[model samples]
Target: MKALKIAKSPDDAIKELLSSLFENQKIKGVFSLFYDQDYFYGLVTDKELFNKLTPTAPVMPANGGKMLSRLTMIEPPAVPIAVVLKPCELRAFYELSKLEQANLENLIFISFVCAGVLSLKEIKNNIEEKVANANQKQGLRECCQLCENFVPENADLILPLIDGDNKTTIFIKTERGEELLQGIENNLVEEDFDSAKLSSIKEERSRYREKTWQNLKTENLGIPGLIDIFGRCINCHACGRACPICYCNLCYFDSADNDSGPRVYEAELERRGALRAPSGTIFYHIGRMIHVSLSCVGCGMCSDVCPVSIPVGTIFTRVAEETQRLFNYVPGRNLEEKIPISTFEIKEFEELGEA
Candidate 1:
């Protein structure tokens, strides 16, 4: 597929393109994000809302994948729709589809050459300045800073964000994309591709990720470190709510059994020195790890919505890497690769847990 280069600011281009999509009846709907004066919001198709879309507006405190699931999980749209999302969001949504929590039948995936997320300050004040300035580089969120997968791999359409490369052409990656974008050839250009720029960027990102992993492993990982970071949790379960993959309609942690009565509290105080008021702090955290570590995509929604500001996403991601490595699986890399839980081979692992 031929890739498109985005030379000028993308907001103008998006405005024109999306307006056309709405008018052409090519798509029944559109799903993406928009930024106002102080906040960013996930929005569905609205021709009334132009030049306000910001698909790459950094600082995503929540996962857009969760939003997509709400739109398409139970019932896919009757007609095709275009949805713009980040790479990580796409990955998480893919996992949800595997669990039968979402369907992708009538949706078009649109993504850009991602450079990772930005800080909230950058999103609010520096967005236009940073986009306009060729010399400036936006600082990434912690999850984004350590991320190895920065580009959207299998989207139907992709736009380039690499600096100084904007002859801005959109690459069609699927027959569906071709159908939707058919004959609207006014703004797009296609040509011979060079993989050097993207490769170099990936290499640098990989190196940084390796270094960050080493540092995270050496200094701030393991059980004790996790407790230290998460000790402030008030048992709010905000992290679970924010996570797209933690899709249990009735989570065990928040059930009636977890509510502590006077007798339950007295038993707890008898066993331990002091009972943490809203009990099961460690239980909740451990349960989360065991339940979703293999599927965790580390979108930073957990950290973003945490009331106490724990780095929940990074902590889960670090542990998840270990667990996923043990199983030799990546959460959303391929739809065909069966999850470790479902794929059993009795012939394998003669002494699986032996020391």
Candidate 2:
């Protein structure tokens, strides 16, 4: 991989690079996290606003994939724009693109070896401390703590966080990335990505994932356990709202057809003798599981936004692991990879019929 070593802090180095890109008219705008009183994903068009860009912030209030979908769903940009996304968020964007929920035309993707993100629950407390401990996995979101896909795929440019010399290492992975850095004065250095470090981290997270998922499985075993875990749901749908993969304009649960009249509630109440006030709560969870399990990137946005702290992201991710394995598929792994459900195979599932 081609490398560009910038002798500045990661945030500062990235800011400078993006500023140069914008000033040189290489990219019309940059999509990254911006710092106001809080960090949020936004587009920075004016060079003056470039300093406010916080591309490596440890907190993720929402997945960037949903924002990109909104930006390019109607039509792709006329000019090339650079989008800086975390590994998981970029994966989610790729999944959305495959679903035709996003257009990838005229876009430049810059990703990073993610150190995971702190939960939104911890966003209000000790921002500096959280960022400092981001790589160590303390106080990070559960899905992030166990995430194995921290390495980005299909990224044009990647920022390496493994080096500790206080230099930002930019690895060029594509011809587009090479062209983007062509005009800039760069030091050509032979650099090797620390694959051993990456493997160690992956192994540690794999062990953690097995242990965590085992506990979750034991806790939520049968239908009653599922009901117990999800019983506190107020049907607020905050999880669905925050989920990057749940991109439907109108969710089935929120549709007018789902609204039960008084008589229907009365009939159900009479039949069961009691009913959960917000009915179909379990059904909604199951429905979402069926819909998004294949494409869930385990970004943890769903669980992060859950008001009742239902661990929605964890549950969905666990289910997704099974579904994706069954289909021998990996979501967001490639732009050209077809979604399993969208395709038809005549001989598929023949074993079920034989039985």
Candidate 3:
């Protein structure tokens, strides 16, 4: 539970600290960040080796909080994988684990206190300047700008970039994390905890969330409201794919058995014929609300991945807050609690009528 600081470059700090977890031929695998495929960043884990990081890596896009949900489905689960993730990713992973979509039995969550990250496009535009002006701050991606969950909620090992200090604040939040850190605890320097600063940061984030939801609600007005809100949707389903709780093996839209493509086209034609696209643009949002509202962690990946720049995460978070409040449930807070729909009492609706 003690906060410890270590002086080292970010990359070197990560490599040195994580190297211990792979010691004594005990580690089976690792899931960490690496550059692969067309993506500049991705999650890679070893399915084959135990002693070293795997050379044959399966990398996907570092699309904020989507990787952990997919990690649940990895065949022949990789145990003791050192997953390098952001705070939102950790929160999403915890929520998914609570919903049974993710199994974190042997996963080591190594999270960063993110200031935010730059998109590839932004990186390209200011490549020369970005290289020169290492201190510049405004060139970050839109998703990173809106992100409020900078401090991790469920990370086993937290790496914080405290107050412009390039070194990391290595803190353990779980028994598993403590066990892992025991090996390198001697190298850590004890520091006075900043309770006030931490609280201020959290308060600022909460205010940002409130302001965002208020604006989103004000913007979404009426019947043409839904259309105007999602008018540019090309039906790509990127939001669904980015969602950590949307864990269907073969989704209806993705399945060959469903005539969803044709159905969507026909619905569009009907819209051209003066019929509204009844829940057409918002079907995924509606379907997800019904499916995983209880488990939604509000990581904002849905909005982050939307090509049309819709505020999908803000809408979901607003709805999820109300839904969770109604059910008296907080997702990812505890693993043992039953999901709302899964729990029912015979006397619960006794006042409604004679059953």
Candidate 4:
């Protein structure tokens, strides 16, 4: 309902806002991306480092939700800290909060109207060009191109990534956001949130998602397809490490219980002509899907971290879509929307013969 008029660039406007917050002592720290040799996330406390804050960076090295969980899983900060994240990261945070892996106390979430992001590899080459081409089909991460939930549902603040707009418009979505803007010299201009543009983007992404999903399904539906896709897996478990939703402290797949001894491998090799070394590759993927598909926010971190170029994020997003649809649930749509697994219904899944 309110927009912050930018005197210079959008980044500068955000920096100015952050500077004010720090100088005013409104926040004790900030959790956001900073530019160094590369863009990285840090809990910034020094006022001098505010210039390095690229809260709108087009590269996501890691999911903000996971990083935030590492900071606050055990205990929340004593003072308020501002957290700047992409819409999907914010949604992922909400999911983690529900799973009791993140504490939501004394934190301000700032999200944005994402224009998608470039792949980590492509970003190192011709960064500006890739950012300019973010709205296009090329150079973006697959999940971003097909992401429908770009508009964050319930963030404290929202920065709209509108092209060719000189003034950086910051929308205050909650009282916390309004309070953060106080004592700052900015006019509160009335403007409608651009629902029309958002709807158009959503439609475009949905079309792309369906088209890509169709192609992916054709290649990855049956057992043979699954093997073809997952056969290259080196059993690195990097996907799970990068995933914000895969927050189990001691993953069963990584624990001693899942380990295969030499005798077991020898017996399996004797029964069959050969065995897939470091076996259960496909089982690991399926197990992860069953565990986190309902809460997955499709942030694309898993695919980004995959050394084998497996489209892990895309597969999980596809699975999450179907599972969430069946349960009539949307993760991180709001704080109050109950996760389907945490609740039970007598009539639920009755059509599937559950009674």
Top of the candidates by lDDT: 2
The deviation in Å at residue 228 for candidate 2 is 1.2
lDDT of candidates 1 onward, in order: 0.74, 0.87, 0.61, 0.86
* lDDT tens digits by residue: candidate 2, 76-164: 99998999999999999999999889999999999998878888888678666666666575788898888999998789988877777
Residues 1-355, model 4: lDDT tens digits: 8767666566777788777887788888889988876778999998888889888877898998889988999999999899998999999899999988999999998888887778887787776566656656678899999999899878988877673556687788888888877877467877778888778888999999999998898444787888888889999999999999999879999999999898889899899979986699999999999999999999999898899999999999998999999888999987788888898888665568645
Span of 10 residues, lowest total lDDT, candidate 1: 130-139
| Total clashing pairs in model 2 | 0
Q: Per-residue alpha-carbon lDDT of model 3 for 1-355, expressed as tens digits? A: 5666657645556665666556533344456555322323334434322223211111213443456556564442645667777665666667666666667766777776666654444444545455335331455443444555566667777765554546656777678876776755565554554556666656656676677777778345555676677777777877787777776768876667544566776776787855344334566556677777777766666776678778776677777878888778877666676778888766675657775
Where does candidate 4 stray beyond 4 Å?
124-135, 163-165, 218-220, 351-355
Better by lDDT, candidate 2 or 1: 2
- Candidate 2 residue 137 Cα shift, in angstroms, is 3.2
If candidate 4 were superposed on the true structure by all CA atoms, what would the RMSD be?
2.2
Clashes by residue pair, model 2: none
Which run of 10 residues does model 2 get worst, by summed lDDT? 185-194
What would the TM-scores of all predictions be?
A: 0.86, 0.95, 0.76, 0.93
Task: Report lDDT (Cα) of residue 77, candidate 3.
Answer: 63
